[model samples]
Target: MEQILDLETDRENQTAGPSGRMHLGGNDLTVDAGRVVLDGTVVGYLYENGFLRSAREQTEDDEDPDTGQWRLVDDLEGCDFQGTTQDGLPLSLPGPSSPGPTGSLSYNGRDYQVMQGRISNAQHKILGEYYGGGRFVLRDARTNTERRSLDEGSVINFSFAGTASDGRDLSEQYTRPLYRDQISYHENEIIRYFQDFDRLDQQQRDYVIESMRIWAASGILQIVRKKEGNAALGNVKHGAAGVTRVRTGMVDLDAEEFERDIDLCARFGPLAVITTRVPSYVEVRVNLVVSHEFGHQLQFCLSQAAQDRIDELYQARLARSIAKFPPPSAYDGGSELVHADQVMHREFISGYAKASVFEYWAESVAAFSFKESRKLLRQLDPGIFSILEQVVFTPEKVMSAVLCEQILNLQASLRFGGEFGKNLLD
Candidate 1:
């Protein structure tokens, strides 16, 4: 037999029991007007067809509670709430929730993994205090171990055994060896030596080390310095001119040289070389040039299929730029062309990106290293962002957690105090 209940009339005429509480399915529900009150607090409201819209949970510290945390119970039967807590932790009702009264919690820029409602640090050393009712007691300072661990593997191991492709060991040529005994992590060794490496100050050297760590850790053949180069700050190339020689099987050379080159087609990586007496600029430009050259290194190291995808994306972006702003006839000089390129490719990170597909990619990589440019890159071309995230930023590719952390920290730092990429093209 089918029984139909008149929900509208029932709700309008619904009244509380003598004690101001109504009994519904063994639960005491207080019906005050159209609201369902639980223990003198309004939990939800009765709607048409006897449906109850559950009220959203509120945080004690939220200024706008209504917009902060909300859960929607779409159906009266077999419905659950799914939303985030006030602390931005994921919240799901009914069973097996996150932070489960004894789990990790990230609050106010610190991580706490608690057991039995007690908070602990990374080394699992308990602070001997319980975090009751969502209250946290943060440590005054991080331990030295914790601080050092942040950049543990950021320094690459370099072996000065084999001679550079230039037929001489640049390390011996330079009087002052800047990074002779600075081995940090136990990853694969790359043959690297700098010429005139001591010219830069400590801060400049630190920036160079941090910026180049990701590429060096990802199997780049070498990091060599050349005393003479064509006015360029840095460049990446295949075998014979840079740090390590890579056998691409395209050119036939002597068996001895071929034996030395690594044979993995995907791993036939390029060598990165900077001028011997490279001038130090602002930190932003220093990081940008190194990372940009490594961007070319990354292109050579990638598989053919991955390279094809990048080419496809570049062509698509180029078409969009051409469509947006057609090229003008006559230009005064390079400045006019640069200005026109900036307006034409407003979606790109910089005007230099309009040079060519390779330049576009290199410029994108350089910009993606900084905080402000990364945000703008995501906004402008999420395709490039997704591609870079998959290929360059993964732990499997980078192979060092410390190097990954260094890249993250470099990305977090703002260039020019957030006025970055405003009028600058480089």
Candidate 2:
């Protein structure tokens, strides 16, 4: 097995192992400008968060016939640094910079050689450059300067700096590996936004909209209700139907508890699942309240795993409730839960709810939409032969008794006793 090591806490100066530098205990080394520090010798496989930082070595001058200009000779043997953007966009390096001639390089399987040339950005044309052996050309459209050289791969690292694209000056800082794409934002902006928001009265609908956006920036989804004609609700898809606000909440209900909450609200999926903060009068800062609402949106968009427990509870309840029905009767070839491929998803059908699994499961899970609950009921009582036929149709062949038995067992586990079942039925 390959050994793993942390350079931050590991002791340095120890005899090197197969993993390269055994370990190092440096007091959080700070890199200054133009300083290169090696964490450990480049060994088997080295990974760094940033890019390699290095100074470009000056190349000797060579004469180009087309431009009749003296230019730096291309050196492929030297190491080069490569940096990637935030979304991993790779920018071309070794291209011409301003005030220089254009160049190209040819790769002969193992080596790369440079072809000298120049291009004019204004004219948008290559002046004069012939390729003898080099295959690739990198041109900086801005500056005519370029180089052609032989290819020799060398180790490189990641590095970067931070400044807003809007031309705001940022404090200069360097992190290794040098080629890493790091971004920094002004901290003062966040502080200012927060202070201004806290002082607002929640009664104003516009304040709720602004607050929701701010909360979203902080990764919180907030539910807010605006009085009328608020711009916040104008552009959102499905913004109407009297359901003004839906946001992700901030509270961290334990995984088990979250499952229980979902079961309780199985009937109100459309409504925002929130903390106990709503009041008849609007007075709180809209942003803070909206943060909780946004969380519900996030919860609604959860993966199947997020509700695995509730799904399991539903399955168990189905099985137990089936035990009460005789074989080849109401329980035998019933709803999709027993027949169709039932994978956990937000959509709830009928039949399953009336069977008793849904009632207890609904209460256990938190806020559910009545629409979903009613849909579950519609499935349970198909009303006529047409709906019943839909449920029992064997799109595939016959369902083995084993499959029915397995499902029944699952339902039994989810069945609730006494008052819990009564509350759901009521």
Candidate 3:
């Protein structure tokens, strides 16, 4: 959530400590001016009872008058200091004794516990830990394996537990569809029948919405639906004609068929299809299918440069597979040849990712959304991860201007009922 704090008013009421001095190691610090100094540099301002406000210099480019010259870096009530003991162990606050078993730290509106001197979630799984000299080691909560080590000031992207950074429950925000303005065709049809998002059961709805959230920044307009049939689990149509559509066929599957589908996906689908030992119905049917189709939509709407990069990666993967197993003939064709090629590509996330470059892209998109699958994708195919990170994954650079314009033109054309309508009117 956005919070606006008036620092000037806060500073006016600020009080000094009893002795106007503090001790740290051998240094005798003076706080008579309420400025926190370290190595002769004023790092922050100190308030009564050890509250701290970080120092920030306002540049000429900063035009926000309300923010002014001095900004409140973090919530005053929250802990802003990370102190180290004489033994060189990290501490959340400056105190003689270490924090208790239930000690927690609040950052960016989220609360994280300090378990045995490590950062943990509500489940008590270690997310990261601090060491001496401003070092931190981040670990994958699921595997408890080290992902990377970072400095104190470095930013790490993590899917923290409970509410989004905006202080809203992400699932609830997704309950009602977002970016409806982008949907220019088949709106009534999408909402009237079984395709309606509300028609899905709670479990199915949750999975589909979660998947949609992954591609929210792609700017690819789509019609998502829940269908009932045995013909196919899910599919997307994003050809030059007609509106782009995505549908999942998991609404009426029986117990046997559902289990069969799950097994089939485990062998040929994205990693999220079977994240754990036993996959849930929602994970197999909704998360996998929706994310995969949206991946296609992303492909259709991305810039030519981005698409070329994707094709380049796909060709490289195909070349590697072909190198391992020479094709039977230059004229070889059909599903048999595709299956053989897929088998040769040992690094593929799933059997289907070897089907074609398009399938590979879609499968990677689906896998990258989940933590377990994301780690697997990063390890098995760092090339795809790099491209995705540059174009789609990064929040600030999600889509280029040309791609955004293409989406706008598509939306405009779709709303006008396709190209033939203009000719007919003329």
Per-residue alpha-carbon lDDT of model 3 for 1-426, expressed as tens digits?
Answer: 011133343344433311244444455554434455667765455432233444555344332323434332133233344432222233333222222122344332345554323554443233445332223454422222333454221221122223322344322111113324333223322333224466556655445444444333222322123212211223323211112223333232233433343445446543423332222211222236545554655554455666677778878877765665343454232111323224323545654565577777877776775555667778878888876665432312434454443333322222212221212111
The digit string of per-residue lDDT tens for model 1 on 320-368 reads 6567544444332111122422432354555445556666676666556
- Note the Cα lDDT for every prediction shown: 0.37, 0.25, 0.41
Rank candidates, lDDT, best first.
Answer: 3, 1, 2
Per-residue lDDT of candidate 2, residues 10-55 (tens digit): 1232211111111113322222211223453222211111112122
RMSD of each: 19.8, 22.7, 18.8
Report the candidate with higher TM-score, 2 versus 3. Answer: 3
> In each prediction, how many residue pairs overlap at the backbone (N, C-alpha, C within less than 3 A)?
0, 98, 0
Using TM-score, rank the candidates from best to worst. 3, 1, 2
Model 3 scores a C-alpha lDDT of: 0.41
Highest TM-score: give the candidate number.
Answer: 3
How many clashes show up in model 2?
98
